[model samples]
Target: MDLTPESNQDDEAVGDLSFDPKGALDAGDGAVLTRLARAVEAVDPVPDDLVERSLFAITLAGLEADLMEAVYLDTPLAGVRGAAAAARADDTAPAEAKTITFTHDSLTVMISLSPAAGGRVRIDGWAAPAAGLDVELHRPGVDVVTVASDEDGRFAFDSVERGRASLVVRRTDGGGGAVSTPVIEL
Candidate 1:
């Protein structure tokens, strides 16, 4: 599948959405997304001003007018806008939200990040061939952990740090796979 961000064909309106990378479907007003789309179309490298322009468009639309918002940095859509990540899913729902699946040898795993307790990051993972697995968080620092799953093959990182992180899983057989959840700055 073509995952290039430049593909406007993916912008085909899906039930009113104009194919948001952040997956913010337009229910009515297209101002913010329209400006985003135009900016994306105008240059190979999107200008930095587009963020302010998008925020301005959102402001004009009166969306969350009081609090600060932007396409980058901190924004509601940035939190869970995994539509690009969704393309890797085995199945696609109309909602356009999905998980990434990695398989190695007899092991198959699906992983995603969510808000953890105490304002930490949550690593929710499911694996096949239920066994002891090593989960590592890689960023500027490395956190190594090993976890054995229940009969259902589910594991989690409840107190993971909030920032860009990747999950690497190692199986007992020494073969493993990794999936990088989209960078989320909490």
Candidate 2:
């Protein structure tokens, strides 16, 4: 089933039957221990050597932490910070990670980047007002600076380093603010 926002409400109707443990037994063993044994046997286990090789690859490729985090989220994982974040977003609308915004009392920013030859990069930024505004580019370890926007409220980075970078947009009006997009790899 598609795990869209609309379908999540249907989870309520399935009820506790979804967590039944007896259903795990592959065979109809009358005894609990036999059922458990049969269930364990029915599952195929990953070999120790294969597991070690996979772990090596994950660590070598920098995927070990991300994989572990995914596994943690799939289980009954919890901590004070995670619990608090979940509680606050229960009724809040989910925001797109790729986009940010800034308004009179708020700000929004969206980013898309592309790579080019000769250690160059291109960045695309959008803002609400297509009026007097300034955009800036911040490369790793570089001093913060501002950029100019075209008439259409768009700015571009002709050629930037192929490393971490950030974009910020400001307005000429007194009420304008800036937004720093997440670190993007060029």
Candidate 3:
């Protein structure tokens, strides 16, 4: 006799969900899993924006917004980027004062770095199309700092300790999405 119970032809009720264990994997299941694993391994595992999102999450203090593109001082660093720096024997060290620019679709921010007393750094920043905005300074292992920009879109962080840092700018009027700059060495 068959072990399975015969269903009533006249029954109209729906079948109950089965809770019984399906038991351990068999050779067929293992083969399917192996094929799936191989297929996954054939493609790149990491997402292209993983690094950008992770950095934004950690450095931007959990700000949800678009990331601004960093415009390296290309004109200023042309020599450093090329063999010109290597050819120069007089001043081989990187410049003490560095300028960086970050831009988004709606905003543009420029910052200047200068040395301060006690081996600290001073950051002077200016945003274009002068408007009310809040600027946040982020450094690893340190509290996030938020500052307000002046009418001229000028802001400054005085006597900041030297380290890697990032800047996040947001509109004070809450008009648009926030934007962040890539972390850079101070």
Model 2, span 1-186: residue lDDT tens:
675665667566656653534356533434767767778867965432344434433333321111111112222554322332343345243411222232333444444444444534455666544756676665546665577777667766666664444455566673534444433333
**Model 1 / residue 88 / CA error / Å:** 23
Please write out the lDDT profile of model 1 over residues 1-186, one tens digit for every residue: 766677667455454644554655565447777888889878776643446434433433321112211122322362343442342232333333234455544556666655444545456778777766665544434444555555567887677664444445555445543323222322
Candidate 1 differs from the real structure by a C-alpha RMSD in angstroms, to one decimal, of 18.2
- Give model 1's TM-score versus the native structure: 0.40
**Model 1 residue pairs with clashes:** none
Candidate 1 Cα outliers beyond 4 Å, as residue runs: 1-98, 103-106, 173-186
Task: Compare the candidates by TM-score and give the number of the best one.
Answer: 3
Per candidate, the number of residue pairs that clash is: 0, 12, 0
Query: lDDT of each prediction vs. the true structure?
Result: 0.49, 0.47, 0.73
| Local accuracy of candidate 3 as per-residue lDDT tens digits, 11-130 | 434334232224577777788899999889678566433465466457564677687888865646442213222322223444356667888999999988776766677899999979
Model 3 TM-score (2 dp)? 0.59
Candidate 2 residue-wise lDDT at 3: 50
Query: What's the best-to-worst order under TM-score?
Result: 3, 1, 2
Over 4 Å off, model 3: 1-61, 73-95
